[model samples]
Target: MQRLDATDNAKALVRQLAETHGDLMFYQAGGCCEGTQPQCFEKGGFFPRTNDVCIGTVEGYEFWVDKDLFEYWKHAHFTLDVTDGFGAGGFSLETPLGKTFQVHYRVFAEEELEKLPPVKRNIP
Candidate 1:
């Protein structure tokens, strides 16, 4: 099963972004002004460290999370969502469009945990 997903609105936004930006990627920020928010960028805009985890894909774009943050959130499933405003850091591509990416999470069920897909830690 996939660990990450996106809302209809978010998918649409990604499509819009890809049309203009070519390709995209997402990284779940750990802290600082970004405040654990999901930031979207041109595929190579923000590099994923070796220890960062690629939980899954959303709209065909890799969705990665910080290693320590991933450890803290290991039991949860994430859904990427979009909202109609600016995020704190304003570093995400959507921020310029007056939108921001957000993540909604739910703890995995016992059965789900058993079948959950393995996360990729090696950055490609």
Candidate 2:
């Protein structure tokens, strides 16, 4: 496993979220319109992906991202900020690498994640 350095701002941001919201899982998935797929996850159980990497933990919550995906984003500079209008869920990260990548955080209900298709892969 590779070691990832979450900026002090990033660590603090994640810790705050976990403390407010019970447990948070980190993973990568398709992005919203005009957004680079980000390392995201809802609050629930998740199957491991081939390239997934568990970088470290924050406030007892595991933080991870697909190794390959993380490498792709390693060079993208990010900024963390907080906002109001959401229930302890306004944390967001902005990348200087343009809108190609989109990172988002939201309160996810357990039932909502059950509807996602199971992860599958085929190697030639």
Candidate 3:
């Protein structure tokens, strides 16, 4: 089982972004003002620090969650989605388009949990 997935709208947006920006990545925000919104950027734009957990990829772009935040959300399955309007921080690439990347979550089933793939982290 996967820790994360994406909605059709989100996948399409990624494709649109890739055509213009080349490559992309996502970092889930966890601090003040940013709340828990997912911030999208051109690949390598925002580097992942040690301890950041890479839940998985959304449309092939890595999706990382702050380690502290991941501890709180580890039990849930995250579904990346897009919506109209600006998210907490305007730093994400989508903000300029009047759209925001968000996550929909649900606790994983017992069987699914056992089969979930391991998450990657910046160990060094």
Top lDDT model? 3
Model 1 — which ten-residue stretch has the worst lDDT?
Answer: 115-124
> What's each prediction's TM-score?
0.96, 0.40, 0.96
Order of quality (lDDT): 3, 1, 2
lDDT of model 1 at position 24 = 93
Give the candidate number with the greatest TM-score.
Answer: 3
lDDT per residue for candidate 2 within 32-119, as digits (tens), equals: 5423343323456565566555544444455555656555654332232222222212222222212122243333345644543322
2-121 per-residue lDDT for model 1 (tens digits): 788889999999999999998899999688878889999999899998889999987788998999899999999999999999888788899989998999999999899999978999
lDDT of 2: 0.42
RMSD of each: 1.1, 13.4, 0.8
Weakest lDDT window of 10 consecutive positions for candidate 2: 92-101
Q: Sort by TM-score, best first: what order?
A: 3, 1, 2
lDDT of 3 by residue, 1-124 (tens): 8999999999998888888888899999689989999999999999988899999997788999999999999999999999999779899988888999899999999999899988999798
How good is model 1 by TM-score? 0.96
Structure candidate 3, residue pairs in collision: none
Better of 1 and 3 by TM-score: 3
What TM-score quantifies how close candidate 3 is to the native fold? 0.96
